[model samples]
Target chain A: MPYVNIKVTREGVTREQKAALIAGVTELLLQVLGKSPALTHVVIEEVELDNWGLGGLSVTAFREQNR
Target chain B: MPYVNIKVTREGVTREQKAALIAGVTELLLQVLGKSPALTHVVIEEVELDNWGLGGLSVTAFREQNR
Candidate 1:
């Protein structure tokens, strides 16, 4: 069983986009690893800007400083 | 930064239970990997019984057969 978890800053993700992500990730796994889709699990988690950080700065603050 | 994706067979999981899971997972990462909580991402995905399988049998079918 292959379990894939996708995390993206929750800014403007739409339902359709999520659907596409789920399909695409599953397809990629099947192609690369020959894993069965029936046992493949793709989960997307939307992180709050404040909760996600890079280089020791939260995405929210980083975006603000850049702007 | 550490990203964690938790996939569990979706059956009778409550919102409170999920919250506890998120918190526990985050804490575990911090203790083991010394990852920061601010940048740690934890997402829980609940898989349908039909979508999760073991030994080529879907969880739904496996449960039924065992029952």
Candidate 2:
């Protein structure tokens, strides 16, 4: 059972994009590893910019700095 | 950006095994999708069996029933 959990910033992701992500990941696993899409699970988790960090800076803070 | 998180029951998994998992996944992405190893990240989370569920039952309960 291949379970993929994708975490992205909460930046107004549309339902269509989420659907595409699920389908694309499922297809990738199927094509690359011959995994059955029926059993493969793709979960998407949206994290707040305040919570996601990069280079010891929160995404929010980083953006504020860059701006 | 490719960041992968793997969650498994807290069954005393060794450090070497976790390292192998990170390396294997990184290699898979590199081989199949041509993702750069430097950009790929793998995080492992050990979950409590009581918190994980299967078939509407906690993993702990499921095991108790099956035994």
Among these predictions, the greatest TM-score belongs to 2
- State how far residue B63 of model 1 sits from its true place (Å): 18
TM-score of each: 0.55, 0.57
DockQ of 2: 0.14
**Candidate 1 runs further than 4 Å off:** B1-67
Write one digit per residue (lDDT tens) for candidate 2, span B1-67. Answer: 3577755567776787667667766665565445578967878777788887768998789989999
Clashes of each: 0, 0
Clashing pairs in 1: none
Q: Give the RMSD in angstroms, all C-alphas superposed, for model 2.
A: 5.9
Candidate 2 per-residue lDDT, tens place, A1-67, comes to: 4577766667777787677767766665565445578867778788888988888899899889999
CAPRI classification of candidate 1:
incorrect
Instruction: List the global CA lDDT of all models.
Output: 0.76, 0.71
lDDT of 2 at A38: 85
Per-residue accuracy of model 1 over B33-61 as CA lDDT, tens digit each: 89888999988877656544453445665
